[model samples]
Target: MKRLRRVDRTQFQKLTYPHLEFLYNMALKYCGNTYDAEDVLQETMYRAYRNFHQLRDEAKCKPWLFAILRTTFLREQRSLKKRPLLDDGSGYLKHVVDQDRKSLGALLEEKMDKANVQQLLEMMPEKHKSPLILYYMEDMTYREIADLLDIPIGTVMSRLARAKKQMKKNLLKKLGMHKKKRNFSIISVFLPGGGL
Candidate 1:
């Protein structure tokens, strides 16, 4: 019994120790926060430790770990008692905008002057943005993205279509094309002795 436990421990350490940081970063990108990603990583590692025997091939370790992490995150999100609204309270807004400006300078120079589309991308919902990012940013094939997200290929296509539409709307509004209407109520006060 002790020998089996020792072998399991060795395998877990050998499989996960080197890839922990990579897995954490990937999880963080999906989870969109440091603390949540950290928790997800920990839970994923724990599960991997318990289910180490289920891994069929050691060569498929990276994808397997990522799948576990992704599943763990999704499960946590579903089980939340009250999901909190996404906000830019952690200075991530500034950081993301700055990085976008620096990295996309060529696009800015060619297309327009100083357009921060990346920050706008950050404001988009995870469901919409995830497929788009995985498709365009990461250069993954639709099939690969579908596999990674555990969704049908058609669903991935639909989500990408809807996501592009939303992105267009958001960009237009941000550029001041579709201004939001403001409602104002005016009250009149009548003074003694009306004008003669």
Candidate 2:
């Protein structure tokens, strides 16, 4: 491992250390559990520390760190040869939704609580869920999400659109089966007109 100099250490701490909580939350979402998330976080931090000097623009630290985290998680996933389990159903989306309140519209925010939104996110496929989580939860731009996920910008936008559509369908289906379906007029929340 490379030893960080005094200035390097200070720079790293200032630029990267503050994002620890963001890393943890994202790792938890990606790994879908605390233990694996911690492992991913540990590896990510270590890698970041070693590579801190290579970062050209300190302003891009978040996306750089996210790329490391995402890459490490994928490597770990491949080595383990098992898909991550969505074991925690207890309001993960709540934290994500709350993290970026400005991105959502007022009406959508009013209609959707943390739990249902979390359920909507959790139920989406990993391909779609990954981008949605980055875009909405982390409030990353489409280009940043594309860089981190290593997909094209067009693909990122397409996936997000598809994810929202899928979420609306799932939410509507779930609500329609319930007695409170009549009271819930929240399908537009996931639709394009409300917000992205």
Candidate 3:
């Protein structure tokens, strides 16, 4: 059996270290807590270190690292499914709505804060959320999202459409607004610069 060559420590660090913060942020989006995000980041770094030799292009490092981190997060989630339930569902932007429908209209008049936006984001399933995160939040192209998710461009488009519709429906329902088939204006207006 052919053994892999030892990686140069400095070389790996130089290439991969710059993206730790991005990876952690992405991890936070996926894991929803600092502790779990840290864990995912550590695991992602480990996997990247181990597979650094496989990287053929330096420009693709960020995307490749993101893919590793995403895979690690998914594996952790799947493993948790086999275990007992311990989550209280209280961590990571968990919001409890108690306002009546009448007051909810007032909320629609105002801008959405980060927590409310994040709460809406958390309500969606991962398969749907991933595309949104990649396309909108990360500003990646649909082709790039499809490549990262290993899905077809058409599937990415469909999932993005469905995800947007679901978010609009959820937001309108939550805020007690009329459920019009309009664009999710808040997300488009607030997401990029409003610091989601």
For all predictions, the C-alpha RMSD in Å is 21.4, 18.3, 18.0
Give candidate 3 misplaced runs (Cα > 4 Å). Answer: 1-7, 86-196
Model 2 clash pairs?
none
Candidate 1 per-residue lDDT, tens place, 1-196, comes to 9998998898889988889999988877676446778999999999998888889999998888989998998899797635544468884522222222122223222233444656657768999989877765566778999999999999998997776666655655666755644311100001011111
Can you give the lDDT of residue 118 in candidate 1? 68
Clashes per candidate, residues 3 or more apart or on different chains: 0, 0, 0
Model 2, CA-based lDDT: 0.75
Off by over 4 Å in 2: 1-4, 82-196
- lDDT by residue for model 3 over 1-196, one digit each (tens)? 1232434667788889999889988897676446788999999999998898899999999999999999999999998766654545675442232222122212322356667767887899999888876776566788999899899999998997787677766676777764655555554422322112
Which candidate number would show the highest TM-score if scored against the true structure? 3
Cα displacement (angstroms), candidate 3, residue 79, comes to: 0.8
Instruction: State the C-alpha lDDT per candidate.
Output: 0.68, 0.75, 0.72
Displacement of the residue 99 alpha carbon in candidate 3, Å: 19
Better of 2 and 3 by lDDT: 2
